[model samples]
Target: MRPRLHIPRPHRRGFLTAAAGLLGAAALGGCDRFAASPMGQRTLKLGEDANLFVQRLLLTPASLAKEFPDSEISPWFKPNGTIDPPDRAYKALAATRFEGFRLRVDGLVERPQDLSLSDLRALPARTQTTRHDCVEGWSAIGKWTGVPLSEVLQRAGLKPDARYIVFHCADTMEYAAGGEEEPETDTTANPGMEARPEGAENQASDSQAAGAEAPADEGDEAQGIPVRYYESIDLTDAYHPQTILAYDLNGQALPVSNGAPLRLRVERQLGYKQAKYIMRIEVTESLKRIGDGGGGYWEDRGYEWYAGI
Candidate 1:
């Protein structure tokens, strides 16, 4: 059945906000040593599965997140996570107002594309005023404008085997030694997206568009390479009407602190799932090869992988 797209009613919106707050608190809290243990890990996984199952049962795949009117837009929308990326490539692009930036879409697709901001703007776009629920127990509403992720996927022509869409971003979570930052590198050597356009630099653009795991070591080796922020969603959510690559926020170009140039707005999920500074979109069959094999940067840190609300 095709998923229906409809704005959630006021009463239901209140219910969803409360429900999402409770879920985010329970799932995204700080991790302790217990969470790192094998037994505790299994227990957390069970909880995550229960949460996922319950949400799926309650909400249809096409269910739209509650949208608010412009009057209700938050006066101050707090930016969560890294506000500015320290990577050299990102800075270079930002220096030029992201003129040379391009969003690389590849992996498990018949046609890999490097879409510029103008290219994304030319595609069909959807705008919505929705609430952002951060796991830290804060909520805010803002208007967002961007291309539906489904449109981009259709343009790229997803392969039959594609099961998940992974978002590659520019924000570096961990820096190398001496505070030096490494340029963002595509996690995989997938031949499909390896080639860049002529004159394209190694960095990640603004039409508003939209890393590593290392072994522990006693010495400088512990620093490892810079690990950029990343998140993923199944094809179901990726195709949802509310899921978009947002380029504008609150009726203006998105601010850097708010994920300028581009960001992912997966409305049904918590804020952490909405990765900012998105540079590439990869359609993959599995998450095993990404970031400690845990699906996302936070997921590797013991957070729930499927944090649906």
Candidate 2:
């Protein structure tokens, strides 16, 4: 049964603001040490524990973030994070309008799933308008539609050992070295998608139209290659009623700039906490095994993992 495509918008309301800049900056200043040094790592662990305990203790587990009335929606909701993913595979999927895209749910599951775009949209879909508060002193309200994360997990048959849900995306943040150009996009790689128009520049136009501007640099790894972008949340937020794998923005198909095909909208937290361009859902017993022993790309860069609002 498809959940309502348009749940009645909630009453216009305000959400409490959290002071995340100072704390997040502090942790980020020493993010590498926070993960590398045994003492720093222990401190981070303590901080995460403190954050989780305090948030759960202070509020009901099912309490939801405020959902705004449709009248309150922002006319131009900005897409701040990775607007365009430079992956050849992802570009091919986008070229085809994502008919070939697949959302893989794996790791520590009774039945792993490889769901296509249609498969996900067919499931119950929930739409909500909510404020997205960015740590960088900005906010916007958007209506997001997708399957509740809990529903997907239920279908996956998660194991008791699962503690965190990791969102793997197609984007990669690679710094451009002084003179090296980023690799050109491969527009014709996937025969599934129609051939790119003359000089379309890989997936650039698609992403730009979708609200993302492709980077000018080559962004190739030989110059500077960082890990792929990813994020994770504990079971608590992962199972929240408002937490969803958002696929549509303001009733239309999600834009490439806004993490086309799929993204996560965990309403209770700050903006960066929402992962975009999601490709896979990996259930794991702990974050230690993931990249750099931190739960997310930003976490690996020294930002705190549990960013509660």
Report the C-alpha displacement of residue 54, candidate 1, in angstroms. Answer: 1.3
TM-score of each: 0.76, 0.74
Model 1 Cα shift for residue 79 (angstroms): 0.8
Clashes of each: 3, 6
Best candidate according to lDDT = 1
- Candidate 1 per-residue C-alpha lDDT over 104-175 given as tens digits, one digit per residue, 9 for 90 to 100: 999998899999999998999999999998776667788999999999988888787788899999876764
lDDT of 1 at 258: 74
**Would you list the clashing residue pairs of candidate 2?**
31-302, 181-218, 182-217, 182-218, 182-219, 183-218
RMSD of each predicted structure = 11.4, 9.6
Alpha carbon RMSD to native, model 2: 9.6
Q: Which stretches of candidate 1 lie over 4 Å from their true place?
A: 1-35, 176-224
Candidate 2 residue lDDT tens string, 254-292? 878778889999998878888888999999988997888
